[model samples]
Target chain A: MLFSYRIMAIPSKKLAKEDGYTRLKDDFKGYLAGTVFFKNTIIHGYPHIKRIFTLEEGIKRNIKEDGFSVEEKIDGYNVRVAMVGGEVFAFTRAGKIEPYASEKLSFLKEFFKENPGIVVCGEMVGNTPFTPPTDGFDFRFYVFDFMKEKTILPFDEKQKLIKEYNLLQVPFLGKFRKSEEPWKKLREIASFLNKGKSEGMVIKALSGKEAVKYVTPNADIEDIRQNARFVFDMPVGFFNQRVFRSALFLEEFGMDVEEYKKRLGDAFYSSLLEGIKQLKKEGVVREEFRVFVEKEETWNAIYSVLKKSKEIEISDVYKWKEGNRIGVRFSKIYRKTTEKLRRFLSGYAIQD
Target chain B: MLFSYRIMAIPSKKLAKEDGYTRLKDDFKGYLAGTVFFKNTIIHGYPHIKRIFTLEEGIKRNIKEDGFSVEEKIDGYNVRVAMVGGEVFAFTRAGKIEPYASEKLSFLKEFFKENPGIVVCGEMVGNTPFTPPTDGFDFRFYVFDFMKEKTILPFDEKQKLIKEYNLLQVPFLGKFRKSEEPWKKLREIASFLNKGKSEGMVIKALSGKEAVKYVTPNADIEDIRQNARFVFDMPVGFFNQRVFRSALFLEEFGMDVEEYKKRLGDAFYSSLLEGIKQLKKEGVVREEFRVFVEKEETWNAIYSVLKKSKEIEISDVYKWKEGNRIGVRFSKIYRKTTEKLRRFLSGYAIQD
Candidate 1:
């Protein structure tokens, strides 16, 4: 993903304090742009940037003159897992705490018990529907870079942490000299993952001065297909992010926002219409469903919840005695078709 | 669905007899396009057309001034099931015999056992992966109109046949008077099928003078979503037809061919690239996957097929005794990556 660098200036801590907590922004620099909080722990922004250029372009521009280490670029979401104040947290690229990552939180907390305040930067791959195809692998975090606050830990220190903590890391292709042939090195890097079909390589200078990505043509094509297709199937929040990311990707390919809209905007609009139509169709049948409340202490609560809900209308309630307790059976229906329509629309709507 | 009227002009019987089978052409005039044969019996072309205008437009234009009967439009593929020489056969809208409609074949054959020349024209709905959501219904034949060779049976006669044969017919909405309010009639028609969310109506004149369709906004929206999505998911031949249909749909919406290409061509290209990349990835492991052929009488034929195939490579062959019979074992691999690539590419390729 690429964006105009000027548009993504790092927000200062003073601003974060002023705002109480920093909210995520659409920043394509991949640089840690801000700080936010979940409970008492600070969720730092991920600040890794990759240059977007073909290997040929990089070579022509003399950007790869410095010797670089190549790492296999895993097709997965950027996640920062850290243990702060003895509690574990996982944040997606958007800097929001991910509840789904709770399964791995205890394992991360174990690492934090030994070494607190270390940030594990990794690509969260597999299991999740959102992640790219993982080639029949289990979902696991692959730590690539470790950091203490804003400073990146040295590769050796990171490796040692991974080894001691039993953390999975991104597959390292190899160390490459500037004199190495670009195509041959690329081929070697590609063969390092998923049977010679790696996404590409992330080239990081040994001195940590610069890091850039060289995506294989195959990977880029796969990205385009995966990004364009099944977007309608994404939950609204993820869909919006994907659409925003698609804009950035198109921009990187020199396609303008207007062009993007012209090409795919109708599909998005059509999806919305489809959602609305589905709601209208489903609302008719779902509204008049019967609910039986068994005799229990929580029956009153259930009744109150149904009675108070503006969306649900109880047309009839019948009292019944069962097992020495009283219960009620209610014929409830949706108060308005618009209520179901809203729920349906939410699944397809684009959000900021 | 729109095609040039002049180009679709009827071909002569001489041409039909000379060609062995004369194919149907797009005739928006709604007259029987042509007759074609399957073995000995003739299959009639479905000559149905709808003026692409709202009921109001039709009224204002004085096109649908006479009284008409409205029928619910089911979104499905047009299928013509018939008995040709005591054998059941189904023809697609293009009048080509369809082998996939085998389930309906036996039923049609039973019907043909009594009335051998009858052609049941219907929309094949449900069961298939590609059809619009069938709302949990099984695959069915919803007969809309019926014909015997080149002649169409009247509405009442068709109903009798459907009742006698226990066949399903497209749900009839109601008869509309020209003096009635077009909007009111449309509303009545809309409320006629699927609990007020009808795909719209197909209005036929009682005098048999004119017939036209009025597709609801909901149906159009459903169509757009269905057309844009799951295109790559369709089988190659159907996928190509869908792409072509999508182009025609866009043109109906006043979008030119170039714009259609500009909007959707990339998705097709991306699908191709995705397919190629997948083939490359899968081919890596699949090329050397082992296969076992147990002792069989057709071993020589199997061996010949394997030997002749450009796709398979036999690394080793040895005589074996299995199940008290002699057999040959061959360690084989795929001969060419390009062969699989070509097959994969064909799946996602778009045809005009």
Candidate 2:
């Protein structure tokens, strides 16, 4: 019973439509929504799902000969940027439209407006130290896939669209025949990501049918370190989800769930001690994600989006009107009273 | 004849002092001011200059046997975070104090306040694709060197200081023995950086007396691509300085100045063509840098720093005072009409 016959609840359609996604019926085997299963085929709108293989599993199967392409697996949130009804919108993988106007998003909005009917899927990496630091206060998006309407474009066409839009895309390592040594290529890419302070690379078929990510061990450690620093401050559920995601990532590295859970337990306690000591020291912590609306009047739209997204609740919303722009500072803050979730999550850490 | 007898004017003292630096006469050969030259001993304050060596020259000299260590060379602005008179200050390599309060800088300031007379030198990488993208709107600084007073601490002490301060530091590659193949080691490091989206590595002596940078070809291409996107928008002098610096970087890769200048010329013109095409499309270009002063009154201190730094001129200073924080949006904006620099820089592109 590795494959669970139990069907998980179907995902929210509003969320899926917002993100241009429809959840597959496959057993995801992970808490995170976007985790790709091995040999899982891409369904254009919604279709049958298959069991997904981890990068490790994929390498063992020698599937590269099936004609796969390797691209830099960006360490960020999956976002779909599209022109719906001639209006540009960016939706997170979980189907939440980013309610903020970021410089990069704004640029994309304008680009989509000019070129209607175009839809670009990119990884929006920000609000974490997953990748190397880029120049600018705005989050950067690296487009990987392209679509027109509901159909995914060919790889070459996707490249053309990226160039046409003057937008950055995930770095294409190269194409490899399934007969070629893909594990060696994976090692090469992982080493590259390690040196560049990147997470890893994603290998997809030329047809854009299947893709799997190979994350470097260093990135995993870095992710743990990053989360440990603020785990104590996060909401209990948020923290548990983070730990679960980290464990899932470790599973890809061949660490059994039990071993990772133990490691996470130790890391959590240690980080709690360190976090406590560091927290006592007074220092400014800037909220990573903030929306600067050009006009205060436009904030109503943002507010409505926030109201609809129950999963993402803002702790505070600071609105200030500058000459022609309105700066809306909203941070997802967790209250200290929620420390009770720590005990609950601590119990679930190793069990999962 | 290899050494340029044509003296580049002494670096501006006001700029250096403002940045908390004293110019040294040691022949420092590199594109940027802070690039260390091989075996060019540090001079406390300003002193007689010595001849600096290009990477090729340094390699040719077989300086690897001199107990040199290699560390990740971060692509960012050089900053010195120190405590003077029990107050925290951040100085740029040009000897200009950063005129704004940042979470990272403030954290360092408080760190220095707690540990008086400690100086931490780091690279604040931002505003370019040369480095990997960080997780926030703010730029990240990676500490490389630690000092107590004017004396440079040993490598281990530097590590200890970094750990004690709980700060990020550039990753340290392995040490190279003179007997072992240093060139191979250099290539290994270069390849690592190339894979990871980093510019290069800085090789320094175990004694901390000498250092030089080794940049990868990939980083050079990225730097060129990034600058080309915005070169048309910069002041002619600033643009020339950037081009010259890039040419200097090319020297690290053993590309002769003439060859680099020719390559730069081609890239400059091509980028100009593309930039012009993209520029016509009316889109938003947001200022990447902003200062958030915790208190409204702190704005004056930032204003004073800007006033003192002649090289960094501000176009508009927008101050919005919120509940307890003051957000100041100031940037060095060059006029669109200043595109006159295109011709001027295009001439210098191949000439300088």
Candidate 2: Cα lDDT at B125? 67
List the candidate 2 regions with Cα displacement exceeding 4 Å: A1-352, B1-57, B60-65, B101-103, B109-115, B126-137, B229-288, B291-293, B297-331, B335-352
Maximum-DockQ candidate: 1
Q: What is the TM-score of chain B alone in each candidate?
A: 0.56, 0.63
lDDT of 2 by residue, A85-177 (tens): 445556555434454423346667777766665656877664321233344654667888875544556667777778887888888888777
- Model 1: CA > 4 A from native: A1-352, B1-34, B59-65, B109-117, B128-138, B188-199, B207-209, B227-352
Q: Estimate each model's TM-score.
A: 0.36, 0.37
- Residue lDDT tens for model 2, B56-154: 344445343456677887777666766544455565554444544233477666676566656677777652212333446546778888665445576
Alpha-carbon DockQ of candidate 2: 0.01
